[model samples]
Target: MWGGNDSTFLQGNTNPVSGQVYTMYHGTSMEAAKKIRKEGFRQSVAGMLGRGVYLSRDLEKARRYPLNLQAYQRVVLKVEVNVGRVKKIDKQGHPLQNIWHDHGYDTAWCPPKCGMVPSGLEEDCLCIYWLIHKSLSLAGVIICRQTKHLQGCMG
Candidate 1:
């Protein structure tokens, strides 16, 4: 998600009474990044908050967890960028083998942001955010279960 140097990591906190740890990540970004993240989050949120959009139970679980604005924002932003990347990759008709790594868990093989560039470091962060979000979108379940591999926030 959109992780800033001062941002905090969203963790799965247990209620103590329930003894359940909710896994999450929290981070922040600039206005541009936030916009992008909002889009992605909207899509995933629909699936998680709305019923049967993506045929997933994540929404149900997400609904129960305490809201961490930063982490939730990051997840949304990541989804937006990821959807765009998948669209770009599909439009180019790139081979699945080439689009993804052979190991299946790696995303380094995905396409780069060919023409999109930011003006400065702030914008650059947004660009990177989009790229990473796109890759994660393509990964779907593979990336969802493993929060350890997630990047973006530095804080």
Candidate 2:
């Protein structure tokens, strides 16, 4: 069964519980970006939301990822994701925090500034069962080049 909406998860571009296709972003190292373009995404073994491909609807949030990398080494991927059957894991210690997929959710979402993320930005995790075109697909890549002014750098 699909998850129902809660007002708290409705602050972003698209409602997490809507089960609609929305534009999202994934940040990575330039090297990883190349590999992803050629080989596609792999679900993370674990994370804040756990065992899924982490993404975000917020461009700024996406730009801050692979956190250790410098701007010049980072790349943000534009993607389209069909956030089907979402489960809102808004709080830091929510029972389904890392295992929403096991509860029949295709995606797990944490809303921005909800204190779940240190950055306080929004985050989404697509379950391994819904990888690639079945739910997520690449749209484009934004390469961050460090300039004298650090213009257009997302790092």
* Cα error, candidate 2, residue 40 (Å): 1.1
lDDT of 2 by residue, 71-143 (tens): 6677899777778888888797899998898888899888777889898788889986787547566777887
Q: Highest lDDT among the candidates is held by which one?
A: 2
C-alpha lDDT (0 to 100) for residue 102 of candidate 2? 89
Q: Which digits, one per residue and each the tens of the lDDT, describe model 1 over residues 56-90?
A: 11222332222344433333122212222111221
Candidate with top TM-score is 2
Cα error, candidate 1, residue 11 (Å): 6.2
Q: How many backbone clashes does candidate 1 have?
A: 13
TM-score computed on alpha carbons, candidate 1: 0.17
Q: Can you list the residue pairs that collide in candidate 2?
A: none
lDDT (C-alpha) at residue 125 in model 1:
13
Model 2 lDDT at residue 13: 40
